[model samples]
Target: MDDVYVELAQMYDKFGISDFSVSFGDSMLKYFDCMYPNETFKKNLDICCGTGTLCGFFKDDGIQTKGVDLSAEMLDVARSKYCDVEFIKCNASEFNDGEVYDFITCTDDALNHITDIEDVKRIVKNANVLLRDGGLFIFDINNFDILTPGEYNKDSFNGYSKLSLVQSRDSDLIKTDVKYYEHDKLIWQKSLFERDYSISKLTQIFNREGFVLDSCSQHFLDEKRSEKWKLIFKKVE
Candidate 1:
């Protein structure tokens, strides 16, 4: 199957992904409130949403929220967890539901997961279409520093279940080796890939599609110190 999360989806929520998503969603909500305190976001759409944890934050604020992802298994997990948030199965690059939203998010460094840069462009362009005029498009991507030649390793255990993750970066590509063990027996192992394009290049591409950078942050807006960057763009008329 093309969906890499087929097997991983079963154990994704138990792997601290949901916990991290809380902080991630908090960051977005904080930024939105800061930027548009006088106004309230009416609708939100999260592309590449995994388990709909991020959508919960918007839903809590009474905003109509929806999530989209390419993996059916991931969507299944999300649907089971978040009954209030609508979930759709489709590639972020090709999704066109003819519905407009006030805010669009594709966080979690999801852009890097698309290997083809053209698809990344398509995703951003499509976001522009799905966003109403003056709508916000927020997303994050791995920066050049993280996409350089490097290696990272980690191992974790949840009771009898163990997970080993080895991630490496060569040039612009990041490859991750994943191994899951259950009760001392290997259950599944695979390699996943991600690619990162430079922030400047993405800026130019988004600009061409009538999106202006509204804000960006690593630690602070316009600060470029961190390895991953969250960017906010406004769709222009």
Candidate 2:
């Protein structure tokens, strides 16, 4: 596993991550509304918050939002975007803290980075500890069925393109090769990895870790299962 994000941190917003975050954040707000109805969240924690994108959304909604990420470089970008918000540098497995939150989110396939199942279990335990009773944990992951492995694809934006290849290894992990181009010249390249876990397995783990699986949607509440699964977990005593 390489810290490809260290190099991509500055260009992440240009790489389409920010827009995707905004769109995904909208769906999360909708899901929260569906679950809580008239309730208001007092605090929110964005686990593995890359550029503080989702945190921005929560802040805009009047929720006190704080973010944690493993990359200081990524947090630099996030701080630049929202100087008022707090962005802490820390790994998911080491996120033990005294503060409790009403809402927690790990979006954009952040959990998949923990290839080890035990590490993932640790994160679940930490989530249970950090969340107040009835708090919600929302996250999304790459669904192998939709993001079928293969090839160098192109994602174009603002007259630039990111050429990338996604390969699914036999070990149940997915590897991504990303290259950014400017005017047809290579600017940057990165390698990223994601672990694949079946929805059933994740649900079982959540149950074991003291979370109740509230619901799951592909992308949005109304959307069908597609390239990813947006899962909702509620912490209960």
Candidate 3:
């Protein structure tokens, strides 16, 4: 499972089709401004922070940022690029440190990679433990409304050398296959799996895990887009 991500890490940034980096940065800033109003938060933790994209943004904003991912290969690339930001290799569902953070983010549909509901609960519960009171835990997942309506079978290209195919095995499970090429020859191929859970189910698990649901919006900062849902939760005091 994770080995796929390892193979993909080297080309992850180049393979991104959407303007996700810009949109994500803008969304995070909007949320941060809304939460702080007059001050800046101290620390941020990015879960499943593949390639440490968001971590770099947070660091540029002068926030002490740390990232955690299950793939050591991904972290290796991240650490190689970002010398200041810390990138730790650990499971998002059970990873923990003694220190708590002011803000946490797990974007790019990272939570959807956890196929088990129990694992989702563990991840949320751990987020509660890892956050201070009033601290935010923001994550995004594939909207079940969008995911279950039809199969996720699509083909796309990233520039010239990278090709991607997304396929759904069932309503709940999605697989993304990527191929990289040099000229006409295939260099590598990799596949990654993701799972989708209903918003209602997630709300129940979050509440049970001692989190107060703050909001759930589409596209993070935007309310109009209908594909992804960004869920915000705060650790109950």
Top lDDT model: 2
True-structure lDDT of candidate 3: 0.76
How well does candidate 2 score on lDDT at residue 217?
77
lDDT of 2 by residue, 17-129 (tens): 66766777787777767867876677989988989988888898888989999888899999999999999988776786789898888988888887888888988888998
- Per-candidate Cα lDDT values, in order, are 0.79, 0.81, 0.76
Considering lDDT, which of the candidate structures 1 and 2 is the better prediction for this target? 2
lDDT of 1: 0.79
Which of 1 and 3 is the better model by TM-score? 1
What are the models' TM-scores? 0.89, 0.91, 0.87
Model 2's alpha-carbon lDDT is 0.81
Clashes of each: 0, 0, 0
Runs of candidate 2 exceeding 4 Å displacement: 152-161
Residue-level lDDT tens digits of model 3 in 61-178: 7889899988988898789879988889888877788888987888878788777778888888898889988888888887656554332322334434645455556667777665
RMSD of 2: 2.0
Question: Model 1 off-target regions past 4 Å?
Answer: 144-157, 220-226
The ten-residue window of minimal lDDT in model 2 covers: 161-170
lDDT (Cα, 0-100) at 122 in candidate 3 = 86
Rank the candidate models, highest TM-score first: 2, 1, 3
